[model samples]
Target: MTGPIWLQWFYVLFWIALISLMAIGGYFMFRKFLKALPKADGKSILDWQEYYIKETLHLWTDEHKALLNDLVSPVPELFRDVAKQTIAGKIGELVVKEEAKQLSQDHIIRGYILATPKRDHKFLIKKLKERNIDISPYQELLK
Candidate 1:
């Protein structure tokens, strides 16, 4: 049983070294494979915001569409053709800044409702109530 203890220890060390090398090789190969994979087009955050808004507009309520249109209505004439989503993205940024203390849902709803014109206040309030939004905080604005 003790014929060659040193030889046994050498074999164990050799096996451990071989396994480690294999693992390292596999890791490098995985890295190389990942590097070869195609990357997503380099869209900016604003671009992504625009794309999402454009794509999802169809799903929005009529009130949402009107609100978005109102939000972008003040753009300079030269850039009028700019995508609605781009304008919406800017409004979203402003809303987030203006209502930093509120929950995201509240801020988004309040921002859109607030931006809506006084003429549309009753319509906006009605739409929000239809959607089951809590309009208690915005009652004064709706008045």
Candidate 2:
């Protein structure tokens, strides 16, 4: 009692369809898993910037480090917090004075320098000056 030829063919086709569907589903699932995984290199923009700043600081001469320390030291208590904002503004002023352009013209570098601790404002200004950034316009801010 063999099955009808047509029935046998139907069974074969049905199994083929099921297995094909399973393979397709598995492929899609694997793709989704890969998409969920983090990038292989794993370094982000912030991580790169932090590395750059650390390397830059590490290469500074002792004189440069001392100058930076002097620049960032805390102001009087009354101006401590406000000083950061003031220094950031002073940076913008310096950029405009030297380049004849707004700080927004080089927002990334401006933002990076401005993100430093308030005490390091002078350090950032000095680094800019070393690059021929001309901080004379903002010198009054350091007073």
Candidate 3:
């Protein structure tokens, strides 16, 4: 049973070939994602976060009744990378927020805010602050 037979050798080669193909396929997929990621608006996704915020604001006015005017909204003119980071859920919220913070250190408003129900916005902001992000800059700007 231990002897090297043609069939056994062929089986071993087939498994090896399959694994090699899978690895190559995975790499190709990752490469395609990277290429498409920065293609939006011809800028990095990070740069487009602000655009999302604007869209969110417009959606809010057009889609729902205004309830809490005091509630701070995210900056309508800043990148929403933090919100996007949380979105992927591929990485932890803390990691993504930290990266977003690092990018927006000087701006003072760092992170993303979506137009969720008024009830959840507070908890969401609290969660962001726990991650060491400040939505104040955007909030203040929104008002």
Candidate 4:
């Protein structure tokens, strides 16, 4: 109340800018921290995901790739690639576990369902239905 109007505005703007920068820095640091953290299996989560995806990259047909792109279409553009990679990695893990010779539509659908969180199951169901993929087989997983 004692200072000039301009000085008061400058003080408020300075604090706002400082807080914003701190928040941005904190976000980056948190991401770096997560990337370094090891998972229960000894490898960092990102490393495992990359390994699974690379292991089965040769098996993914054009159709399978297209289907994954379609499934991730609803995600925002900024995060779409990460979403695709995560889902693809999960699918690859499934294929490896089963020692399957080739990827199938069933594998893709099941992987998508499992990769997504439970809170998003409704969206998953709607998306799968839109593609005309049966959800009956995954009813238990969804719950």
Give all candidate RMSDs, comma-separated: 18.7, 19.9, 14.8, 2.8
Model 1, residue pairs in steric clash: none
Model 2: which residue pairs collide?
72-119
Clashing pairs in 4: none
Write down the TM-score of every candidate.
Answer: 0.34, 0.28, 0.26, 0.80
Writing each residue's lDDT as its tens digit, candidate 4 over 13-88 gives 9999999999999997898689769988889867878999999999999999998888888888987898898899
* Stretches > 4 Å off in candidate 3: 1-4, 38-143
For each of the candidates, give the backbone clash count.
0, 1, 3, 0
lDDT, candidates in the order shown: 0.58, 0.51, 0.44, 0.88
TM-score of 4: 0.80
Looking at model 3, residue 24 earns an lDDT score of 95
lDDT of 2 by residue, 1-143 (tens): 88899999999999999999999999978865664455557854334434444433333456543443444454566654444344344444444446533223243234435545546666666666665766665454444
Stretch of 10 with least lDDT, candidate 4: 117-126
RMSD of 1: 18.7
TM-score of 3: 0.26
* lDDT value for model 1: 0.58
Residue-wise lDDT of candidate 1 within 79-118, one digit each (tens)? 5445354445544555445643322445445555554457
**Top-down lDDT ranking:** 4, 1, 2, 3
Clashing pairs in 3: 49-80, 50-78, 50-79
| Sort by TM-score, top down from the best | 4, 1, 2, 3
